[model samples]
Target: MGKNRLQLENHLFILPDYLNHPFISGNKLRKLKYNVLEAKKQKKETLLTFGGAYSNHIAAVAYAGKEYGFKTVGVIRGEELADSISQNPTLTFAQNCGMEFKFVSREQYRNKNNPLFLNQLKEAFHNIYVLPEGGTNALAVKGCEEILEEADAKFDYICCPVGTGGTISGLINSSFKHQKIIGFPALKGDFLNKEITKFAAKTNWELNLDYHFGGYAKVTDALIAFINTFKLQYNIPLDPIYTGKMMFGICDMIQKGYFDENAKILAVHTGGLQGIAGMNTVLKQQNKPLIV
Candidate 1:
């Protein structure tokens, strides 16, 4: 399942089976593997990371920490969850995985790079290994290199959605032979090309920013409807936030004659299907039928 590809209409290819790997089950898993290994190598007793309320990174860190027997701390963005919380399945699962949650205000969380912030966290948790938010550290990039070896195929272009740029950077660096490696940013106004090139430095690949329909986490009725129809037609589920936007942009580009008919496009399905839970409620409230 690691080398999966689906030739969708208009020359767009989807690699849905990338989600099947135990360690590479999702983008977060791929990013976490190297970080966890590094923490072990350094003999770190605790793993400290940052993420939003619904972050996949938090979930991945929790699972990885448990597997590695390292104490885990999640510097969660936003207010604390209620005493008897019901929503946020991922957070609940992370808690169950033995991750200690620390809530910080949005303003304080934004100071992630400040020395004071690091000192404070260190004071609270001694010998803690800090992983950047979303696991967008150098180690994460090194970890992402495995993805290219996993997908050993010759293709004109390799595409994936860009968030913090770790996955895209890692893929681009590892896929030096690929003709083009494009990153479609899900965030509408995000300057991902600049961010990617800045973080990855002097890469020999084209960064395409033509796909974001609106902005990060932004979904419209048309987008939701497209996800539903696409799933019904192909029996593949896509979360509205990430892969759905990426597939939408890929097909849109194909229809617009962006790629040659013979072009071999490999769309990396960076899995985050767990996000669909929130969208499901929205869809049902709007009386939209579930595709599956």
Candidate 2:
């Protein structure tokens, strides 16, 4: 599993996790590993989850559910996206993987966990195995706990992109006492402070909120330039949503002496590469340089 990996500037990096499998590569694979098994354990035949137009979670759940022989339902966040699924790359990919959709307005989507909303889904898809959006549940965190290994204990810091807090929380739980887990969140706000810790068991972790780059899916010219330059230098394509921002934060922190000069760092590339195509389309419309 240590494939497409490299070391740079005293830091070790690995491929987009989405590359591990044609379908479930990246963090999605790790997040779903135990959930898939639990679903099978219950003999569940349908997987229900939620996400937006370009959610890696949606695509991953679709592919994993299809491959593992479970029916997939993606309750997409934006109701407007339903009519234009063919134009949306992520949704198109999930649809191709046989994922059914239930488009909900942003307001309704926000209430995804409301007992009433969940009851509606339960009624629609009986005995379905429900996965929280971003696929971060206890079992998913269990899967992420395995992302680190015995050999990884040597690093002084373990960095990862945080979306729904599951991945970083898993790292927090499995991290060694000497290794601090630094999460570069893709979204603004301290909301994640509570969400991530709920599943974490360690105190050796922190969230660098300065690198969100104007909130989720929001990017600037400077960010695009960094992404382009990084890809050219490292020969690694990073999605703008998660890994790109995390890498930018790490480099900024490194330059600012945030880490010890000899600190060894490991960054998990969670694999939101699929969203690049969609992001590029938007960039082109905005007359911006594309992520190369």
TM-score for each of the candidates:
0.88, 0.96
Off by over 4 Å in 1: 21-24, 80-84, 150-153, 199-210, 281-292
Candidate 1: residue 263 Cα off by (Å): 0.5
The residue-by-residue lDDT of candidate 1 on 90-188, one tens digit each, is: 678778888898888899899888989999999999989999887887888887767765444567788887888898888877775545777878776
In the predicted model 2, the residue pairs found to clash are 17-25, 17-26, 18-25, 18-26
Which ten residues in a row are the worst by lDDT in model 2? 1-10
The true-versus-predicted C-alpha distance at residue 80 of model 2, in Å, is 1.2
Clashing pairs in 1: 187-216, 188-215
Q: Candidate 1 has what TM-score? A: 0.88
TM-score attained by model 2: 0.96
Could you give candidate 2's per-residue lDDT for residues 1-292 as a string of tens digits?
A: 2444467765555535556776687889999999999999999989999998889899989999878899999999887887888889999999999999999898888998898899999999898999999999899999999888787767788899999999999989998888899999899899999998799988899999899988999998889899899989988888899999988988898889888888888888888888898899888989988988
Could you say which candidate leads in TM-score? Answer: 2
How accurate locally, in lDDT, is each candidate?
Answer: 0.76, 0.88
